[model samples]
Target: MALVLAAQRGRCCLWALRRQRWNQVQRFVKWASTIGGHNIGKILIANRGEIACRVMRTAKKMGVKSVAVYSEADRNSMHVAMADEAYCIGPAPSQQSYLAMEKIMQVAKVSAAQAIHPGYGFLSENTEFAELCKQEGIIFIGPPSSAIRDMGIKSTSKAIMSAAGVPVVEGYHGEDQSDECLKEHAKRIGYPVMIKAVRGGGGKGMRIAHSEKEFLDQLESARREAKKSFNDDAVLIEKFVDNPRHVEVQVFGDQHGNAVYLFERDCSVQRRHQKIIEEAPGPGINPEVRRRLGEAAVKAAKAVNYVGAGTVEFIMDSKHNFYFMEMNTRLQVEHPVTEMITGTDLVEWQLRVAAGEKIPLMQEDIVLQGHAFEARIYAEDPNNNFMPGAGPLLHLTTPPPDSFTRIETGVRQGDEVSVHYDPMIAKLVVWAEDRQAALRKLRYSLHQYNIVGLSTNIDFLLSLSGHPQFEAGNVHTNFIPQHHDELFPTKKATPHEVMCQAALGLILKEKMLTDAFRDQSDDKFSPFASSTGRRINICYTRKLSLLDGENIVDVAVSYNQEGSYKMQIQDETFLISGEIFNEGDSVYLRSSVNGTVCKSKLVILDNTIYLFFPEGSAQIGLPVPKYLSAVSSVVMQSGAVAPMTGTVEKVFVKAGDKVKIGDPLMVMIAMKMEHTIRAPKAGVIKKVNFQEGAQANRHAPLVEFVDEEAESK
Candidate 1:
């Protein structure tokens, strides 16, 4: 049956091709009527950040003047600087600027733009916005508003697919809101169902409920989150396919009723329901399945009269049965991989299609050239719950883009990674002949990339790329959390390594002091040493190393100015710049075993020298005649602190709020993102030092928690 359907579709496609060829004169006339041979003169972009910049790059290449709309916070953003003209839409919050349709339209009018390109997020998928563009007599460089409306709603899109004979995941997409109703639906569908917001993207307002209790509990939370994030609380329940591979087909269409599929991309590697990595030519998709997937996607696109470029996403189970997911109506972050494989510029096609031109390529012309992968490098700490890191990027560097690798970014050194935007620093993509080669190139690019003064997940990405299982391509959706222990081993530096570091620190200090004395010794004399032969004193202390197998090591060094020195271990001699001092108050020591060298700060207090290594202070008795006492005091403390450097989103606690354990005291929205901070324990909030829209540094205290004493019975 499938083969028969394929044959019919192929025949239809060929007939359409013949008709298109025969009607070239009529097609030319239609094209002239729509575009009038006038290329886009000016384009207004209704988005911000890297995506906006990405669109402008293509716009400029096509000789189109680009206009950028930005909020006050993004005045100096790269996108603003890249545009031929820029206008301030509103303040920092997106509600006033990016999502403000009136303001965006005003900018378009003021800029005299011939078209409006709603780059990815913001209002890209908003059917009303697209409709407004048409009403204003400006080209909307995307799918038709009708197509957007058709695919904008999950339930409606699934129904449309069902009508088109496309396979869809079994679930309930009705308007039922009752807990019992959803619970019944979950049971009918089976356990382990996915609750997703109908209007949500980017993994927001999605939850996985395993049982009846969980379904009820997660439903309200998902609704609330969906409302807050996307202003829509309506959700749909779908059957969760275990170990499913996320795949999507890129499709393009024109006004002449022609559409073509550009193969598929695998975006299965994800965290928190958001994709962190994506690749082209999915790892395990056989040739037969690939052909079917492409055909289905083409049918899906044709069902909606889709124009311009769009994506049809799917979830394929282990048995190779694929189910239709959602369709993205705009350009995707992972489009670079598809470009790498097909050598097609989707942005260019979007412009050409919007201008009423036919798709420039046919099915046979589209061919997968090689494997490609893209890793989204984010300003977040992988070691600390992936909390978004926001601060001024003090330094940024990466290798140049070549045939094998590409780096797409909108930031540079001295740029502020503000909390009002996504924390994605850049997208690192690599292309090679095969999957293994692509993975290797990705790992190399990640290692070579460097960003300072802000935490990033570069190290974590490198580790994941190089992991045995990941390299072998034998991973599932739950791979990260499942094998986190093995991938992220909890191994601290060995005692010998610490000792070696300490020795190196000492050597560096000695060299610095020696250089300082050589440059300015004539200006000032040392207080511990006279001009002749008086002794100098040094004191230093460092942290003790605790390693595996109960191994511990402490490093402390002290010296006096006199030429005579006392050694604790007579067999070991401290190497100080190739000089051996038999008797001296100032003695330099380097651990020969570990290659650690140190300069000591010797103090002649009660004939004892003190050693410090930025960790702690230690006292050493000089002259070999006194007993030694080593005491260590280490301090450990914790409280309400910012997990990462980000702008304060909201502070819920005040000077004296009684709070129970697990109560949310504050909410932080960073990198144009959001997170909640809960109470560590049952306590009274002593003080709240931050407010909404304030900058908070990493580890800075935002509130004080005073523990409540047990009441007397």
Candidate 2:
């Protein structure tokens, strides 16, 4: 009866899916009318990666064609495959490719695309790009150039917000950018002020000086990053609201001068000042507060005659007193959370509004439905301050998508997460009836997202979402730092049972492969050809060494004649039996350890065994022999080393220069952020390994340090 009911339910789901697709087609047909009196048949996506794929998905659903402009590096990217037309503009560096406006415009002209969608990041909020689209007679599927200009500059946006009756943070948004003047203003505003570049967004060129002593250093760092990212280093000082919640309203405007907000998203949990997870219809907000947030956001939009999708960011205190932080004049990275609760396709709205149509739904017509969460999964080692990483996605598996779950991504399994772009692998989004349910769903979905290759933040995100404070929705920008101990608990050794399971998996996999080889060879059906470790009237023991991080564990497996085995780890021993099976595209291991049966997904790649159980995952490495390990390890002289792959932007010390501990050695730009390499100990610089604009791999020494005594000798 249960099987019958499940079959019926499956049919019902299929029917629902068919209906949804049909409805989408009907909606597209309706919107297929002329845009701005000219049929917008094709749109040129002026971006790359996930956002580009996101725009193309909507364009395809709307029955419109999409043209993708990619760098040479992205010639075979997923977005290129998805687009109706694709063109290679230039090489990998964004300045010559994705950010090259003239190349994109020429593609637009050549492709005869009626519009361009700057899908977040590069050229998304570029005022000049928006204006250039106008000059080229192409509809930029975003806000007006004037609006982008007004909001692109933090100082200008603050003045406009203040004039428009929006509560603005108290700070200096003045013309005097002198270090001394900014310092005086920071002193006036008080310590713990935010030093932000005027054109900063996505946490770039933003810093917090907790006290007056570090104000100048923080300011200079922010200026350098600002200059690198925006080509403008002018900064604005704002009172950094301690323990504030980052809430932002999603507002949309049309050429008809009508606008509305889609409530708010609380991006309070952040690292390096960028949002890690986002949820919509902010956790503790009341209906009254929600209405006011929406109204204020709409007012800000109308103030600049904004069009298309825009996010108005606010810094809210415990008392719910909100102050304008800044405005992102393009679609936000976390926009899907807003869409989940509001049941709106914002990209479609962007396309429609850009075509000179009114917003499909007004303020009263829009209703917030359920709670949603978006957790950004990046290629980074969370234990190492979340420093970004780049490599191949050797194996990737995500939870099945449904009505309430989404995996927004651009790269696929076996694709490289390049060093030249943001390290985000995908955005895992989930929705449920309420906040707690949504939180639970988010955790469950995260557990199913399995990846094998370089380091990832998946385990860290799991730890974060399951934290007591985060589960209760009591989130703030400093939540991670405040709960560091709980979030980053001391490492524990791998459980004996898990290690046993890892050994069994390895044993079973090897036996299977050996059996396959024997079956294909002339030794087929030969008793001696079996590698099952079975000997006549004798038990064979095989010892294996596995590396867990830096520590190694030795496992002894004693094979029994009856196909079962006894595995010993340290002093613990367990009888284990397992058979590996190939299911669909995944490898599964059904193992009985001490008569406790369990199943786990197994993936072996790059000398590491990855075991994904229902609850969690484990990684066990096959230790390389000492001789090979020594040969592969690159030894470097005592010096400052790069934390990740990036370009050396500036070198502060020359060869033979004396430096104290913690002195700046050089600056590197990587994964769209700036990192300063500081001296490890007092020494004289023997040699500089890289100059400005030279690429450096992770852990590569930037400077060779010599001892003071040796230099004196």
Candidate 3:
């Protein structure tokens, strides 16, 4: 009994001593920052994309030199150019480059940087990487390694929240991860349970099993995704919530047990469990509920001794009851909206705090300024179920910057949206006096934004902004599904006026090329000068095709002298005249039709033309003549072909393996999403053309199938 008392006394003394030291450090930082900016001499950013660029801007403002590390694919990225010094860490694939801990550390040491800032994704929340920085005596511009470990694992975080008196849904988080154990838990939780991988983020490795019959299959899929994404397949089961809003509170803490909440953000607008749009001061939340949420968040942060910026997420029911979900111990993607409303630069605070600075403002000093919204712009086709897209940015434009508008992007007009990284192009943030005004600005900005060569969700975004239900703030996790028809209206046939604009675009492109050639030649007059119109009185026909759903409409164009053309569709004909003007990376085409002059922004990419106006856009294609189409057999339905350019990840069947309808053939991964190719019909796999880990072209054959009759013979 005496020994036990003595040991307890010793432990109390050690805790008191450590607490004293932490308080001293906190006091020093708070004093130093107010007098002058905390000086971090130099820092290296160990990530890529817009978030990396965002950190560098703040670092420069703080008088700190910045270093950048990039994969071979990102060698020419904007972040690399923005940094004072840059280095290529490894090859294009992320594992060999951006996620290579040793390479990132080596660059930091070589550049003599005093700290490393991991921008959101890649290695931002990796506790092992944070520990490596501590061992090297280099500061990590994020929460401490201890905090990362505690909050990164979903099971551990839930347990900690429960101990702190925070409400958490029933979930099985255990050491025994056998399939049998998980099955038993699912049965207890009842049907429609949520199976989530404990070590995963970004909505990966999460699945919903609605019945016992489908539980095992979904569990296996979730495990595979988890293992491939996070290198950990352990999972936890929880009761799924219906009609829940994803609300999260921002919190900050220091070494001296000082913590404050920075209001809340409504991230209920999501797809694939990833946020698409986010707003500050979550809609419909009252003062009392907000206060309770803030208190809960602060408590959660203090439980982990969290330092730096973090978000404590919750799932709120329709009646305003909220439950703790998990904590993200790093910067979040939708942070810009928070900054807009709070009038604070979260990135700047991160830099100062990492350099031993403290929170500059107390709880009373922080106030919400106005309403703000952030819309993520992605290269995807809304018509194709929002599948990710990759291509060159043949044409690009964005809303002009102002006090109420902010455009955050890491790629330029001519850059390529590679298949190896996220397809997000930019974040469009708007601020205003109220929600209605902010939404109006969001709609205007969406109309102003434009892209070519690949499809984007700009039109869909505009539709969503004008949605009557959305305008009334009727939002939830399942909002999109409930309003799918209104958000994505059916595509209609192209108008004749639009086809005329496309013809004008093609003519303008030819004229520019000819003019360029003439200027490069020594002789002022070249024989290949741009043709003004069809030769004298002769008329020539050109065919134009526009894609709508699964079919194509062909329109005929007849050219006459002096920039005149006639577009005809079976029984209808429209005589059109247009003039085009070129401006900084954009072309404006003015078309005169039906005694009205309509102007449109034009973009011509190879054989395609895009016309952007006030309402939306139209894609026009220069179709090949029927004679050439017959000779060039570009599409083969019988052969398993890649839908986009990517690296093949797996082949389930080998040469001569028999396959039936809907059987798995291969897995093709691109832009960080996986697509499995299935056999279309019963047949024998005559040839597995490409091996695993091989590069594939768009629509290139992967496996060739011989007819069953031919195989039998």
Sort the candidates on lDDT, descending order. 2, 3, 1
Estimated TM-score per prediction?
0.77, 0.95, 0.88
Q: How well does candidate 2 score on lDDT at residue 486? A: 93
List where candidate 3 sits over 4 angstroms from the true fold. Answer: 1-39, 508-568, 573-575, 627-634, 645-660, 682-684, 687-698, 708-713
Q: Which residue ranges in model 1 land beyond 4 Å of their true spot?
A: 1-36, 494-674, 682-706, 710-713
Tell me the lDDT of candidate 1: 0.74
Q: Determine the backbone clash count of candidate 3.
A: 0
TM-score, candidate number 1: 0.77
Q: Which wins on lDDT, candidate 2 or candidate 3?
A: 2
RMSD of 1: 11.2
Q: Per-residue lDDT for 291-313 in model 2, tens only?
A: 99989999999999999999999
When 2 and 3 are scored with TM-score, the better candidate is 2
lDDT: which candidate is best? 2
Off by over 4 Å in 2: 1-29, 33-37, 525-528, 535-539, 635-637, 707-713
Model 2, residue 417: what's the lDDT?
89
| Number of colliding residue pairs in model 1 | 36
